[model samples]
Target: MKQSLTAMALCLTVWLSIPVAFAGPPHGGNPGRGGGGFFDSTNEYRDAVSLQDLQERRRQREERGFERLKQLKWQTGYTMPQHYRSDRYKVDYNYYQLPRPKHGQQWYKVNNDYLLIDDDNTIIQVH
Candidate 1:
């Protein structure tokens, strides 16, 4: 009887502690809503856009990534930030921006690393 009681207590403890060991996302909603999510970061109103459209945008960006990066007017609206906390956009270049996110595949810098992000805010490629 004592052994059975101990086993039950142990099982209960493990069940309760499982959440702490592998906690879910903070928001507890869709895990891929913000940050490095499966959707677009610029898209403030996720309700308006359909999933198919978003997927299509990502595909287009991946296909035309090279052309878009080459045509970027780097000297125009882009400028090196005064301070950066993370090396998310590291690159060899001195100038860095917090990703002027656009509608298609865009090139960015994150700590000596060149990143190519798709419309879905997915890192398609990196250099």
Candidate 2:
């Protein structure tokens, strides 16, 4: 009976001590001063543009691309249907046996008659 009681008391003591040993200061207390999270660096950027500005830029790009394609078609010597109109035009100067110029802005004539038109459609240039 005494041995059984001693074993029970030992068991009780160990059970009680388990929680005490587990209860230490939290591994790392919150930093004493205010600090942002890992992703909260102040130097990081989060600025955003207004939706209207974004939409306007997209629209301008689409318009410019369409006009450029149309111009390429017209300048490439491709025949456009009677009812068809392209925002872009292309003229082919290869048929005339003319040497290709180094600069694209230099105009070239095609079929002894056609003129290549170069124009700024909608691109914005920054100095």
Candidate 3:
């Protein structure tokens, strides 16, 4: 009876070890998702995403922003055109404070055109 119990325990141990052994990094291959279970495919994918393509994409975005500034629209109720003017909105010691306009008037500019927007998002003046 003791020999039978020992054999049963040994069988259970071997059964549990089978799955655990296969679950680890298979053979000499990496367990990472980027690799094909054995080979590193990261460099291949990284090279595919060329630097020239990324630079060109950034240049296009910059050009688009410059174009938007050049062509200021008569759009009212707009939250804000450019995020770079955030300094003007905030009271920072480093940035120059914009002079206050008439009561209840906030000046917003896209490019060279200055738009006077009121508190209620209404266009008061466009120059």
- Which candidate has the highest TM-score of all? 3
lDDT by residue (1-127, candidate 2, tens digit) is 9999999999999998999897644333333333443344341343234566788899999888666645553424344332222433233447544345334322333223344333422111111
Model 2 lowest lDDT segment of ten:
118-127
Candidate number that wins on TM-score, 2 or 3: 3
TM-score, one value per model: 0.21, 0.22, 0.41
- Show the lowest summed lDDT stretch of 10 residues, model 3: 89-98
Q: Cα deviation in Å at residue 50, candidate 1?
A: 46
Query: What does candidate 3's lDDT look like per residue over 1-127, in tens digits?
Result: 9999999999999998998877755445564654345455664576567876898999999999878757757665654444534536433222334456667666665455566666665665555
Global lDDT of each model?
0.56, 0.45, 0.62
Model 1 alpha-carbon drift over 4 Å, by segment: 1-103
Clash-forming residue pairs, model 3:
none
TM-score attained by model 2: 0.22
